[model samples]
Structures are given as structure tokens and as C-alpha cells.
Target chain A: MTVSLEQARIIIAQTFKKGSELGLKPLSVVVLDAGGHVQAFEREDGAAPGRFAIAHGKAYGAVMLGMAGRAQMARAEAQAYFMSAVNGAFGGAVVPVPGGILLRDDQDAVIGAVGITGDTSDNDVLAGLAGIAAAGLKAEA
Target chain B: MTVSLEQARIIIAQTFKKGSELGLKPLSVVVLDAGGHVQAFEREDGAAPGRFAIAHGKAYGAVMLGMAGRAQMARAEAQAYFMSAVNGAFGGAVVPVPGGILLRDDQDAVIGAVGITGDTSDNDVLAGLAGIAAAGLKAEA
Candidate 1:
């Protein structure tokens, strides 16, 4: 079960739409396929200079962690040093933030993920999850 | 005219299809907009490791050079030191390979580029050019 390009477009579009509807800032959204390759990505005009990198990092990180979004946040917080090590190990590919979310297909298998940046972490999570739901997928958690 | 994600997908799909029809190996492909940002990318199952980097470098080099595909090879041959400096400056993002081609719109303006890896450079270029044509776009020269 791979994340299709159409689904990736929906994920990116709906992520920004939800962010705007919720008064979040312009966003950079990234969707990665199960293979960790970028399926589709977009950086809205006026998005922060480095938002795309942050967004991609978050999604890559979430997928590499093999768990849903921030379900491991508490664990990461308790082991900050280990988390730092993971970041170093991945070469900054993982952001370990709320905006990164693991997505599941109908079979409930981890297929890929959506990552958003340019807004507060909480709002970024809201938009990312909303976008996944809009695409008829579930956020693994 | 920017290369939309839909167009990028078409290019990638047709490139892989062409490669298969020619009995070539599995491949990794990348499409970058004029800004050198990834619009879409794919890595076929069983593609060799490091294919993605090579593919991306090819596309990045094509777009950055503002020429069509391997058309710059002749210029590079005349100025080996200059071309070597370019490759070093771009940190290997600029590959002087045949597999990268600049995409052009109806007005013959460059909009993006496609890069493919995993097969011979000649076969990769054939697939890349075919994919661009399949998307109803031109390969700028």
C-alpha cells in the first residue's frame, strides 16, 4: 500500500487549507511515500525561508521512527539525549515534532506520512491530521 | 510555465514504463521545478542504492545549467576546469550525464527538468526524453 500522488496532493492541499481555516500561517507541506522518497511537496508563497526543510524533516523523522506522530513525544522527552542521537544518526531527517504524522492505509498499515511547517506546532498537528482525514486515511496513533 | 505535479507524475510513470519496455533495470526518477525544488520523485522497488542521489543530481545540474540535457557536455569539454569547478560548487548536484533534460513549455521556456538513474546513461536519456514528450512538453536545447 503506497501513497499515491493524488493522495499526496490532497494531503498537501488540505493541510494548507485547514491551516488557513484555523488561522495558521502559510505552510510548507511534504508527503513521503512508504519508501521515504518524496511523493509530492509544496511550499506556499510567503512561507518561511526554511519551512520546506523543516516540513520534510518532520515527515521523514516520523516515518523513520516507525510509530505515529508524537505518540513517542513523551518517550523522546524523557530521553532527550537519545532523541538527539537519533537526529544525528538520520542526518537531520527527523524533526520529532507535532507537525510530523504517520499515515495508515485502510489495512491500517503504515503507508507514509504528512509533515507541515510555518505554524505553531499545535496548529501544525491539527492541520496535518485534518489533511490525512480529508484524504480518507487515518493518522497512526 | 511551471511543471505541475500531475505533469511530473506523467513523466516519471512513462519513463519507468519505457525503461521496462526496453528491458532496462529498475530506476529512480526525480522532477525538479525551475527553482530546483523537488515537485515529485519515485524510486522503483529494487532500484540500487544511491540511484536517487544520482538521479536528483542529474536533474539539478540540467536545470542549473540552463541548457537541455547533455548539450552542455560540449561546453564542459572545452572548459574542463570551469566545469569541474561548477560540479564542485554545486556539491555534485550538477552531473554532466545524458540522463538529465530540461523541460520546456509550449513557448519553449524552461519550466523544469527530469532525471533518471539505474540504467546506462544512454538508456536513461532515452527514457527521460520519452517521458517529457509523453507529458506534451518539449526538451529545451
Candidate 2:
């Protein structure tokens, strides 16, 4: 099943809460359903305008490719031209970055994804994991 | 000044609040800076997957053209070819419709725009106006 609105809201809220506890910069979070459609989003007050698009692209790429962001990052490095073409094909929605995390069901099926931005990519991933945990969901390891 | 993320959140929150008060269908709301960058966006749980894109297009059009959605609709009808060309120029971000509204400051300077979708266009406009009003912002009349 796809992520419900209530779950998406929880994901966003916990993502921000984690970011704040870590004393990171203002963050932007986006939750997308299996089809890569936005379900919910939030940008912290001091976050830059572009954070939403960046977070969206990251999560969209993860959900659309059925691959975690870290794997996509490796592939992007090894196949620059292919990754570039894919990015163009998706109208710049696929961002091969570390902050995109895939949400999975108990059956290991991807149900949605979370993307976080406005801090280091690793920190973003940490926050994303916290959000997924808060929602009682699984994230691709 | 540009629309802060706080204001953008209020606009989206109040837009959905008004939509619920009116018993409208699930809605998607998008807030954009005057430069047409997305500041905040949300789609209700039952909203169609494409609602976010549609709402974003409407608000982006209003902000980019410096005109209200009603005026844009009239121009779009009278000059279909021009409107088509403009839509292409903006990568399909322009949607001339009633739900798009320009947000203005105390001095009447355009600050941003809001777009709502998933209900009747007229109802969407009403919801958007309520949102802008709640945010203490002016709408281009």
C-alpha cells in the first residue's frame, strides 16, 4: 500500500524534529507515494526556496528507480552519461544523492520515499531514518 | 520582502481549512515566491496525484505573469497561441485558471502567489482568497 497522508505528515514532522535535536540547519522534507507524487512537504522557516525541489527530486529518484539513494549515487558516478540522460528524461526530478530513502512494507515492497535537504547529505539521511522509524515503517538498508 | 516559509505554511493550512469548511473535495495547495519557486506545497490524502503539479502551474503562472488567474484565463482564451507559447517557454508551469492568485504586500507589491485545485475552480478561488486573507496578505483584485 502507498503511504497515507497521516503517515506522510508524521514523516515530515519527525524529520524536522530530528533535525532540530541535532542542531542542524533548517530542513526541507518531502514525502512521495509509490508513484512519485508528492503526498506532503514542509520547508523550515529559514530554509532556502530551492530546498523543496531538491528534496523532491531526491525522493522521486529513489522511488522511480527502485533503488536507494546511495546505490544511485554509485551508479551515477560509474555511468555519468546514463544518469544524465535519466535525469533529463525525468525532467530533472531524479537526484542521485544520499538523502533519499525508500520506505518499504513488511513484505519488502517499496511503498514510498522520504527526501530531506538543508544539511549535509549524511545528516539528512540520518533524519530521514528517524522519520521512517517514527512512522513504524521500514527503510531500505 | 519575499514570502517566508511561515507565511507559506499559513497559506496552505488556511487554504485547506477553508476547503474543509466548505465541504469541498480533497485539495492541493501550492505557495510560490514571486520568482515562481515553490515555497510550500501540500496535497490532501485523497487528492489526485497530479494535483500538486496542476496547482504549482497555476501559481507559477500568476507570479510569472504578474496577473491574477482570472485575467490570465481571459488572455489565454483570446490569445491561445501566445498562451501556448508561454507555457512552453516556462516548461509547462503556466496554467491560466481561477484558482491562481497573486499575493501582494501592504504597498501592493506582488510578493508571491497561491494555487488551489481539486474543487470547482470558483470554489478553489474562494478557498485561496480565504487563505490569503488569513495570512494578512492582499490578493490582486
Candidate 3:
């Protein structure tokens, strides 16, 4: 399905609610279309200033590299040179980590991504995944 | 010369101040060292949601390609294919416009860049330039 701003917002809103329900610290969340254009975003109170970048970078990095950040971390070790070159080339915009995942529609096409920050990378990833699932979308991995 | 975090903060703060003084909307400012590491950044209230990505991409483009975004726009004329390839490859992170600039310390060596968004592209350029100047840094342009 097409990536709609409404859908993105719904997902993000639900994610924020879940975060609050869990009593996690404030979070910054973003959704991007398959084209990587931002679809929706929300910054909770007290979210760090740079949290937006961290979330975007993780999402963009995952999309660009076609894998989760954790997977990238594993690959980065053996492909250190390649990863470094790209990292250098992208100017810190590309941060490979597990807090991001591609969103797939029922048809299994990559529709978009959800990213969150303001906790451990693992917690961030879990939140992102929850948001995607709550949106009634599926994560391929 | 090292790019101090303080200088980066000053640059971002001034850029937002200048943008607001001119009646521009909230803005996001990015500072990148010559090696393209993030020195600092700030996002103003009501700033366009994704001003963050555009600012970073604009700055990254300037630093990596060794030309301002406007110059990249000009180069895009004869280099359309290359430009498209870049856009295709980077997914929307390659913003080739004039809103970003190279920064140099007194020694005149390219040290880093600053990118701003939340206004017209011209204003974006002006904001970045203002940040650089306010920080007492020079642009190689």
C-alpha cells in the first residue's frame, strides 16, 4: 500500500502511547516512505536535541543497506573498510544500528520505515518494531 | 585546528537567531567537520519536521563534493546523469543546493560545513553563512 501521512501518524501515535504506557523516557519517532521521504514524526517532551538525527540516521541506514542495524553491525566487522568508506562518504548521516526496520505492506512491498530513539539501541529497536506491528504492518525480519 | 563543540553550538544558535530575526520559520542547523563528523546541531521550535535531514544532506553534499549546494545545482546542468545516479544511490540524502557552505579556521584549511533549513534555499544559505561568520569561521567559497 502507498505510504500515507495518516497511516504514519497513526503508527507514531500508537508508538508514543506504548512508550508512555511502559514508562520509558520521552522518545523521538519518525516514519519514512520507501523513497525515504519523511512521512511523519513526533518528539516527546525531554527528548534529546539530537535524537531526531539518531532516529533518522538509523532508519535511513537500515533502508540504504537493506538490513537491520544489528545485522549491519555484524557485517561491519568483516566489511570494515566498506562500511567506513560509506560512513565517511555520508558524513555521519548513515548510522547502522538495530533501531530501524523496513515496513512492508500486505503485498510484501517495502512501504516505509519507523525509527525511535531515547533509550538503549535495543530498546529503541524494540519500540520501532512495536510501532510497525501496531500499525498493522509487518516487518520482514 | 579542532572543531570545538562550543563553536558548533554557537554557530547553530546564531543561525536560528538570524533566521528568526528575518521572520523565517523554525530552522534546523547542522555543523560538520572537514572529515564530515557532526560537530553540533540545533533544531528550532516549529521547524519543518524533516529539516534535519535536508540540513544534514545539504551540508554533507557541500563537504563531500567540495562545492556549495548552489554550485552543485549548476554542476547538475551538465552532470544530470551523475546527479541522478547520486540521488538514486543515496535515496533523498543528496541535496544539491546552495544552503550549505565550507568552513575554515583562520588558517584557511577547509575545516567543516554548516547547513540550515526552514526558509527559502537562499535564506538557508544565508543562515549557514551567518552561522559560520558568527562563529568567526571563514568559508572557502
Among these predictions, the greatest lDDT belongs to 2
What would the DockQ be for model 2? 0.66
Question: Which pairs of residues collide in model 2?
Answer: none
Please identify which of the two predictions, 1 or 2, would achieve the higher DockQ against the true structure: 2
Determine which window of 10 residues in candidate 1 chain B has minimal summed lDDT: B43-52
Which one is best on TM-score?
Answer: 2
lDDT of 3: 0.71
What is the C-alpha DockQ of each candidate? 0.22, 0.66, 0.05
For model 1, residues B1-141, the per-residue Cα lDDT tens digits are 678867887898899889999999987788888777766667676665457678888888888888755776666788878878988998857877678889888777788888888888889888888888899999852
lDDT per residue as tens, model 1, A1-141: 778767877888798789889988887788887766676667765565456578888888778887655755665888988888988998867777688888887777778888888888888888888888889998863
Which of candidates 1 and 3 reaches a greater DockQ? Answer: 1
Local error of candidate 1 at residue A53 (angstroms): 2.9
lDDT of 3 by residue, A48-83 (tens): 556767877777776666676777766778788887
lDDT of 2 by residue, A22-70 (tens): 9999999999998999988888877877888899988999999998889
lDDT score of residue A139 within candidate 1: 86
Q: What number of backbone clashes does candidate 3 have, counting pairs of residues 3 or more apart or in separate chains?
A: 5
Every model's TM-score on chain B: 0.93, 0.96, 0.89
